[model samples]
Target: MSMQTPKQLGGISFGLMDPETYRDMSATKVITADTYDDDGYPIDMGLMDPRLGVIDPGLECKTCGQHSGSCNGHFGHIELAAPVIHVGFTKLIRRLLRSTCRECGRLALTEYEREEFRERLQRAKDLGEDPNDVLKSAVRQARKASNCPHCGEQQADIKHEKPTTYYEVQDVLSGEYSEQIAAAMQPDEDDPDDEGTSPSELASQSGIPLDRINEIVAGEFRPRTEDRKALESALDIDLTEEDMNKLMASDIRDWFEDIPDDDLGVLGIDGEISRPEWMVMTVLPVPPVTAVRRSPSITAA
Candidate 1:
């Protein structure tokens, strides 16, 4: 028998699974958070669904029809109600947001700058060199642009708060407007008969739910006239507020989708293998129970 020499490793690539791919690999859709029912049986479509592989010794996996010890287990998925930013990619998302045009979703750099960076990226790729430095420089240059070269729209400063929040900062209200607004909102102590609108009434009129108030305050939601009016009427204030719009995962995903494939290399992303939008999770993959379950010996120990 002849022995074959091992082949040399060329490179390694990591990619995120898009929603469709996640769904395709999932054994079942995990609809309920419950693991077991009242009878102690695994609930269908729950976290411990038999289709996701059984943890119990006697039970067989519903999907693979193998006993607990033999079954490698299958994956389950949960469809999120709303898109959310992946915590791991918060920095990358922020960098992408800052480096791209808010209006056109193109790189904020001029044509010459873009071409230059692209050339640098291509050279790095050809040489099998790390392109992170080139990407960082390109992103740094792009962030300096106040207006998008492609669409000529004024760009706002992209701010990333720790964990997962992102905000677009733009000046909307001047100092004079702020003072006038404050004065209008202040109650007139001299007028004994005046009863101002209450905070509850204003909140109700704003059409924003209580749960979303934090997001609204953090600039995740765009300001609407009704929302502004509610605060103004409640305080009896006339004011122009600064634009601190929150960028939600869905919004970011849309922006990423608009980015040209050719430009992805400059951003240090391989468009063919992965996409920026995939960084924002719409579907969550759940491991089978057996994979996560502790062995009886370990538990006893």
Candidate 2:
């Protein structure tokens, strides 16, 4: 009972078994005027409610509260045809709608309509408009404008954002920060590394450095996000799972291990390891452990 699909546009709405109707109608798809949205949902036909110039089918009337109306002002005319049953087959009936006119809203129905209107709609449909055009026009009407129709604020400045779905969020985020995001999605604090040790294994096997690990993990002394990006670019590393594991296992001090203080140029921190060789550290993730409990015996009272 969606209020806005082509079924609505074709002046065909309410409830019907679509699969059964498709079989009965000998139709393969429930196509409307426009077949897709930006993300590819079939546009609803209610977009360009067509009208038949004859007896008001009452189905297309704008009178919302009377005669079991859907209250949509679309679908001016509908052509109702008999359920075409072939031979010895019985099937459920579902209504299918197609827009006969893109303007002055009209439709062909299989349920309620007089023959005169059907003939008129047939002539009009034969004379011109395609269902696809009507659907596309409707989608255009439903599209969001740059400014809020009510308040007139621009989309960028608006506070009430149209909540984005996971799909849209991914589309937008991937398009904008594909590189940075790629860098960020390294092996989550799990999985093994080159040395055959997971972050948790490294933590347990080398516990003495836990404090330093915490410092980096908690963002206390590690390089700022910007600095990390700069280093990533300098190393020409992807900062992916392998790269992250390598970085996490090795201390920053190891970067300048045997290079003399005079050769601090190797790090290019303006000839000085600004972070100090001693304080530079490696981080290992801690493992999560679950408490195992023995089942208690229930003694008879």
Candidate 3:
């Protein structure tokens, strides 16, 4: 056979793989954490499923039908019970969340500003120059808008707690209520009839689970007027129109999905190879056993 060598090397681009692409390339789905069976054979649908590739010398690869030494191996995938944020991309995700409208998923900028940014990004790309500075400027401007220019919905400040947790600062008690609540919460030893609200009660009300908040936001759960009144009376404070809510991986993914392809360039993303939603992982790829296992000689050493 004759071989041809290339004179010039083209550039390489890296991108995240979406779930569809992951499943398409996978040889099997790994369900169990267990690797082998009681009889010392690889288990089907398990982490060490033979379909993922052969690590043992005598065994043939189920996917490629080749012996261990000759088989290059294949990939397997695991479907996560819930979507999870990729730790590496948490900062980028936070930037995207702050710069885009939560409801309309468009850049939180005026029409003129959006057009201006798109042009700058496209010009930079055409010159083969880095567009990071332009992207940062757009994010900075978008973050300043209190309401979405496209949808007119109020935008809340998104705060990231260490690692992966994100919280939306929806609303706060007004100055008047803050002062009243502070006074009401104080205990007066001289007046035995005075009862101060416990801290635990306040914590419970404020720390509503993200899932329940999602339901409430979707109009799936509605509190009766009486219940609302009762809660206000018990707390000795009026609840704000919107309560602070946590953002889950799924919620973040949904927000990203609403972003249009045309806007991705301004967000420092290439829409052709990567979508923003893919940053939150729904499926994980597992390398073949041969690629991970240590040889007997290396293990002994």
C-alpha lDDT values of all predictions: 0.78, 0.27, 0.79
Per-residue lDDT for 1-301 in model 1, tens only? Answer: 7799989989976787778988999999999977777766778998889999876768888999999788999999999999988898888898999999867789998889999998998899899998888999998999889889899998898888888989999866334543453354345789877664343443575555654544444445544556656655655655464778988888988989888777776887878888888998889999877887643433444
Report the CA-based lDDT of candidate 1 relative to the real structure: 0.78
> On residues 15-67, what C-alpha lDDT tens digit does candidate 3 reach at each position?
98879988999999999988767666788988778888887767888899998
Clashes of each: 4, 25, 0
* Over 4 Å off, model 1: 1-12, 125-129, 173-242, 294-301
Order the candidate numbers by lDDT, best to worst. Answer: 3, 1, 2
Where does candidate 2 have its weakest 10-residue lDDT segment? 89-98
User: Which residue pairs collide, candidate 3?
Assistant: none
Of the candidates shown, which would achieve the greatest TM-score relative to the real structure?
Answer: 3
- C-alpha lDDT of residue 49 in model 1: 90
Model 2 — TM-score against the truth?
Answer: 0.14
Question: What TM-score goes with each of the models?
Answer: 0.72, 0.14, 0.74
Give the per-residue Cα lDDT of candidate 1 at 119.
93
Model 2 Cα lDDT, one tens digit per residue, 59-93: 23222332212332212211223222221111100
How does residue 289 of candidate 3 score in lDDT? Answer: 76
Question: Candidate 1: lDDT of 233?
Answer: 64
